[model samples]
Every structure is written in C-alpha cells, then in structure tokens.
Target: MDNDIKNFFKEIRKLDDNIDIPAFEEINIKRNSPRKEYYALVGIAASFLIVFSLFFTDEKVQTETNDTDYVITLSDENTTNTESLILEESSIYSWEAPSESLINNFND
Candidate 1:
C-alpha cells in the first residue's frame, strides 16, 4: 500500500507544469473585485432614497379627516360652577329655621 501511494504521487507530479494557471486566476479576481464598487453605489443610492423619503415624502399629508375639533365641547346653556353651587348651599342652610328636626321621624 505504501509503494502504491508513492507511485501515484510520483505519477501526478510528472504532469505538465507549463500550463499557466496564475493569469487566469488573476483575471478572475480582478473581474470579481469591481463588483464591490457596484455594491457600494447601490448602497449609497438606497441610503439616499431612505433619507429623502423620511424628510420630503410627506410635507403636508392632509388626512381624509381634518375637521375633528375633538378636544373642546361648546354649549349654549349656562352650567353651574362648583364655587357658585357651594355658595348657594351655604346661603340656604344659614337661615334660622324651626327645630322640626329635633322631633324624631319615628314618632307621629
């Protein structure tokens, strides 16, 4: 088995070395390297489009419903404020009334 392996390796080493693999490989590498520049250009274009959309795409987006005055409600009738109600209650209870409350409601 050892002798068979050595013979196979010696036979493989006898192959022609005049074939130039370097030039073909150099051309392939150069051709593939230029794709990096194309990729960079595409990246820049995509970034610019994203930025432009964020800033300029919607200057004034008038939604279909802009007439919603939802925060404030207006009424024509006058409503009683807390201060005025307290004042009125105080004035009513301040009068001298008969001591009918002294009689218990449980009696006749």
Candidate 2:
C-alpha cells in the first residue's frame, strides 16, 4: 500500500510540473466622475452655514407681561352646609398553607 501511494504521488508531481500557471498583472483603478467631490463640498458648505447661523445670529425675544388680577369670593352659608361620609366594613382574606394531616388524607 505504501509503494502504491508513493507511485501515485510521484505521478501527481510529474503532472503538476507540466502545468502552466498565469502571470500576475498590475491593475490601476481610477475615479471617472467628479460628482463625489462636488457633493462633499456642498455638504461641508451646508455644515459651515448651519454652524455660523447658530453662533453669529443675534435675535431678541420679547415677552409680554399681564397685570390682571383675579378674585374669587365664597359665601359663608354654603361653607357651613357640609355632609359627612359613612363607610361600611369589608371582609378580609388570608392565605394559609395545607396542613400535614390534610396532605396525608389526600394521599391515602
């Protein structure tokens, strides 16, 4: 088996030596459109305009003042007629675990 494998590899190596491989070629990629540069300049100009408007603009805000007064008057007779509220008792609920005897009765 070893001799057969060695003979197979020798044949493969002889075939590999006879095969021709291609040579490497240098490729140069260049941009053919100037729209990318124009877009970038436009974006930069827009950012600068926004920054200048936020920092250099001077605008005054005017607020109006209201001097009107509001007065509410309550009658003494209406204040004296107040009624009391009555509440009824409600039942309370409690939680308890099952006793050992109950568990044993169920198991039986």
Candidate 3:
C-alpha cells in the first residue's frame, strides 16, 4: 500500500507541466436590496388596505336553498365587533421608537 501510494504521487509529480488552466470570468450581476423606507411604505399600505376592508366589508350572511333543515352562519355580527376590537387593541403596538437625536432635532 505504501509503495502504491508513493508510485501514484511520483506519477503525478512526473506529469507534464505544460497544461494551461482556463481563466474564470467574474460575474457582475447587480443585486437590488429592498430599502427600509420601501418596506415601511409597503407595510403601511397593506395595513391600511386590511383596515379599510375590515371596516367596509358587508356583514351579510347567505343561506343555502336546499331543503335540509340545517343553516350555516358564521356569527350573528359578534365576530365583526370582536375583530374590530382586536384591530383597535393591536393599534397600540408600534415599530421601534425614533432615535433620540431625531426626536431632539424634530424642529430642525
């Protein structure tokens, strides 16, 4: 085994050194990272859309025309009030507070 390994390495070392390796070209694809302001704007827009839809959505319940004496209803308008209350409660939570320097220099 030792002789075989030595023979293999000697064979490799004795190989011609005139072989040329191809140069690799660098790839330069420009990557666009999302900005903080863009994310904030998108978040604000989505929140407004959700709130608007919740506030303006119709509270009507549709009944099936089948003769089976079973009617399925989501809730008796109680869920709507509960959802609104939840949204109101969640409004108390906010993003990180502004930097102290920004707060102090608000007039500037």
The lDDT of model 3 is: 0.66
Question: What are the Cα lDDT values of the candidates?
Answer: 0.68, 0.69, 0.66
Clashes of 2: 0
Worst 10 residues of 2 by lDDT: 59-68
Candidate 1 lDDT trough over 10 residues, lowest sum: 60-69
On a 0 to 100 scale, what is the lDDT of residue 2 in model 1?
100
Over the stretch 20-39, how does candidate 1's per-residue lDDT look in tens digits?
A: 56776677664446789899
Q: Tell how far residue 5 is off in model 3, in angstroms.
A: 79
Ranking of all predicted structures according to TM-score, beginning with the best and ending with the worst: 2, 1, 3
Which candidate do you rate higher for lDDT, 1 or 2?
2
Estimated TM-score for each candidate: 0.27, 0.28, 0.23
Better of 1 and 3 by TM-score: 1
Please give the RMSD of candidate 1 to the true structure.
Answer: 9.4
- Between prediction 1 and prediction 3, the one with superior lDDT is 1
